[model samples]
Target: MRLRVFEAYRAAYDKSPYAVAFATCFVKGGASDTLAQFKIERAESWDVLRTVKFASFSGLQTGCIQHFFYNVVFTRAFGPQRTMLVAVRKTLAECLGYIPFVYMPNYFMLKSVFNGGSSLSEGLGDYVAEISGIMPNRSFASRVWLLCRSAGPLC
Candidate 1:
């Protein structure tokens, strides 16, 4: 049974990686939010909207963006070799470049839009505020710098 399931999954993944990833991440994200609501947040009831938002975000961001990043960007830049140096470089690139620039911006934008914001400007405002820990009008470089700074001595 397990072998059959594995083969099925492998076939699905091989056939369409992005679709499989989207489905997988969508389920995983919804499940995680459900678990967090019950266990960590201790909510009395399920938040359907929150679950939807998380699932959608995970499907789009982790599924598509992460797939592209790890498979294409990382492979092209770092090669297929596995080493400590490569690991460190990958980590640094993800943290400094991807997370700060791509991921967080998308997250904040999605969050704002999901939470009833009227515009992308509002989302950008929220992103700047969250990252810079100051006004919502900070420069782009400043926001990135502040975010990287919060990563502690690694920056």
Candidate 2:
């Protein structure tokens, strides 16, 4: 359940350029430490068992690697000869990283949410409302709105 929500949040952000910025922030601000702290705090607050699940970490790293490979390698390797296969592979790889928890469960949940006629924008709005309760700042709302707008009408 928690993983599904996190994946939804990740997918919402992944469609926007903010993914790059978020990745940069992760790298520049100390990825391991920040992620560890986040896991620790989140686990404590949410009472999540197995807070440092190996599969979850693998999924997160896979997503990071996919983004890096796509932006750095795929763009250069394929150049103007992009194909549907390449795009699908990239998208799948990102999904793997974005939704690490309950692999099949998360995938199906997202598929149902997205394919059931709800717009990505609606999902993002819900995400923003949830996050606002935790962060409670103007900038967070501004960032969410900016990212949603950048993600287009569906997002």
Candidate 3:
């Protein structure tokens, strides 16, 4: 079953990698948000709208951006080589460029738009508060720790 699924994915990816990437990220976003709501947040009911927002943002924005980053940027820079040096360089590039520059800004913008106040100034304020750890009680790391604790002792 897994092999068949992989084969199907491979076939689809070969034809339209960007579409596959979008779909994959969409599903991932939906699933992760669902889990967070039910398990981590411990919501009594589903928040379908939140799930939709997450899926849409992840699919429409991050997916295409990631596809371009990996396929175009990294491929052009690193070539087709799969050596240790190339692998390290690519990893460094992803860490240095993608995480800080692309991912965090998009993530914070999504957070601002959805969770924070209506106005742009309010959103920027929220972003500043979050980044500067001014909202100590509502820190991202605390949430992650809570999530890890919920998972099990192994965490």
Question: Best-fitting candidate, measured by TM-score?
Answer: 1
What would the TM-scores of all predictions be?
Answer: 0.81, 0.24, 0.71
Cα lDDT listed for each candidate: 0.84, 0.47, 0.75
**Residues 19-69 of candidate 3: C-alpha lDDT, one tens digit per residue:** 998999999989999999999999999999999989988886667788888
lDDT, candidate 1, at 16 = 96
Candidate 3 segments whose C-alpha is farther than 4 A from its true place: 116-155
**Candidate 1, lDDT over the whole model:** 0.84
Q: How many backbone clashes does every candidate have?
A: 0, 0, 0
Which digits, one per residue and each the tens of the lDDT, describe model 1 over residues 52-144?
A: 999999999999889999778987897766665666667677766998789988988998899899977799888887788744556799667
lDDT of 2 by residue, 16-134 (tens): 64454445444543545445657755433432222233323333443454455556654565443345555544444434433332343333434335445376455455555555575
**Tell me, what's the RMSD of every candidate?**
5.8, 15.7, 7.3
Where does candidate 1 stray beyond 4 Å? 134-155
Q: Lowest-scoring 10 consecutive residues by lDDT in candidate 1? A: 146-155
* Rank list by TM-score: 1, 3, 2
